[model samples]
Target: MKNLFHSYFESFKGLRKEIWLLSLITLINRAGTMVIPFLSLYLTKNRGFSLEEVGWILTFFGLGSVTGSWLGGKLTDKIGHYRTMVISLLLSSVFFILLQFPSSFWAICLGIYLVMTVADIFRPAVFVAISAYSKPENRTRSITLIRLAINLGFSAGPAIGGLIIATAGYSGLFWVDGITCFLAGILLLKLLHPKRAKTEMEDTFIQAKSAMSDKPYLLFILAMVLFGFIFIQYFSTMPLYYSEYHKLNEMQIGLLLGLNGLLIFLFEMPLIKFLESRRHTATGYLILGTFLTGISFLAINLSDWAGILVVGMLLVTIGEMIGFPFSNSFALNRSDGKKRGSYMALYSISFSISHIFGHNSGMQLINRFGYEFTWYLMLGFALLACLLLFILKKILLRENV
Candidate 1:
């Protein structure tokens, strides 16, 4: 028992103090991730937008995300990660509050795009910070620790968000989301300050390359974009599935989504630790995890029973647990420490593209065809992603990256 506890503690032992504080900030920021999960439902049910309208709105948000990520990367390189993160957090908070005011469809669409543009600027900055703070050997565990924090916060967000929606409605969700973001900003302001380190300066001088010119990295990004398109449907369409198809309420949808986060929190850390102990390959995990992702969607499309949904959710969560952190670490390993922000930004673009093509096209498919058809599409594409990832892994190994 003592050995087990010791090993668990050791998993978190090597990360820098900044990593710990970043994890805390991540926890606080993600705990209020109420807006996005329920955005589709909010637009449809509250604002009475059509499915296509919601899809377009989400697509616009993705467009902004792409722009923000590119610009944020440059900003992180030119200015610094700390200042970039602080500005993104505070401005995004203001945007979140402003988002609550726009009622018309076009106005709401523009508002959402702006909000996402500002908010997503934080992604690459945070990644750069993680790389800057941790040693190379412990990088994956550091990324996993951040992910663990994110899932822990997600576990609370949906569960509490459900209650807020039930009693206080959509406006309350925005208020709470905005407030928490502001608090996270204030916390960062108090805790983190500017500093110049010799190691960073040396790294900057040693590796001053552009990620855009890296071919292997481009292929890796393509693979993530493909996989992400399929994986992202859980957020974009799954809540509507629970509410409309399975006849679950907002609170029930929240609970079900919360289950995904709770499972990750319980199992991800131990699983990653075990994998690290055994010296598992990132490729092996990525392939298996992607295959499991297909099976997850398959399990549910085959049945509508609530029990089946739980089983599917469990499978998806497990796949996510295995895939995402390793992918982040893989991106980190492939980049120069000096250009970590740029590489991470490029990697983040895959998700932005997924948001655009995934949610927008997904909603269109569901509206035109049916939910089962959409699931079938996701399952088929997930298998394709697995194959692509397998090939990409060989390429990466051959390139010795």
Candidate 2:
């Protein structure tokens, strides 16, 4: 038993100190992630916006994210990941604070777009920082650790945000979120320094135009986009589902969503560590994981009970555990070593694209058809993603062969 415990922790061994610090920064920032998780509820319940309006606002937010992701890639390669992350983090804090002042529908929509654009630019920088700090063997585990921190913080955010909302309301939530982002930025600025040598520094001058030309990478991005489209339903629609259909309160909704992060914290690291040496490839994990993610939502359609929601969320969390780290590894491997930021940014754009389509289409479906139909449609999409990923795996193998 002791040996097993030790072996489980062995996966964490030898990772750079910067990786751990990066994870800390992620934890602190995500713990204050109050706005996005509850944005629909805030708009509909607090501000009295229609569901369709909320969808449009979210779409606008996604549009900015897509733009930020593209620009972030260009800047990361031009300046450096450290400066890019610091700038994004600090500017994001400003945007989050600015977000609270807008009351009109158009103003709120515009606010959301600006906030997301500045905030999301840090994503690729975070990926690049992880790649820069870790050794090859430790790369996948390093990314997992960062994600683990994010989930841990997410678990705290909604649970605590529920309390704050009940006591102080949405304005308090905004202040807390903005404050945490600022704190994270300050900490990152003080701790993270660029460690690249002269050769690595010169390599940054190399253009990332090559990544745009890679057909296999482009295909993989498409598959990731589909997975993202299905996965984002959790954020974009699930809260509304729990509230509208299940008639759950804010506290209950928060706890239900918090369960996702808690399950990831408890199970993901140990499971991944145990499986790391089983000779599994990222492709296999992606295929199995994407399929399970599909089945998770389908399970939701089988029952209306809250316990069933937990079970479905558990499946989703497990699938995330298997898929996400591998996806990061795959993206890193497929890109030029010096231009990781550009490749990862392109990869990050997949989520932004999904956000643009998923929220708008999901709410439209719910408004027109109902929630169950939305779930069914997403299930079909997930299955299609699985087929594409399978094809991707075959192509990858053929290229290697």
TM-score per model over all chains? 0.86, 0.88
Write one digit per residue (lDDT tens) for candidate 2, span 210-235.
Answer: 46777888888998998888888897
Residue range 257-369, candidate 1, lDDT tens digits:
77887777667777887787787678778877778888888999887678888888888888888889888888887876547668889988888898788876887899999
TM-score of 2: 0.88
Residue ranges of candidate 2 with Cα displaced over 4 Å: 1-8, 41-51, 162-170, 197-201, 238-256, 300-311, 366-374
* Pairs that collide, model 1: none
Best by TM-score: 2
Q: Clashing pairs in model 2?
A: none
- C-alpha lDDT of candidate 2 relative to the true structure: 0.83
The lDDT per prediction is 0.82, 0.83
The lDDT, on a scale of 0 to 1, for candidate 1 is: 0.82
- Count clashing residue pairs in model 2: 0
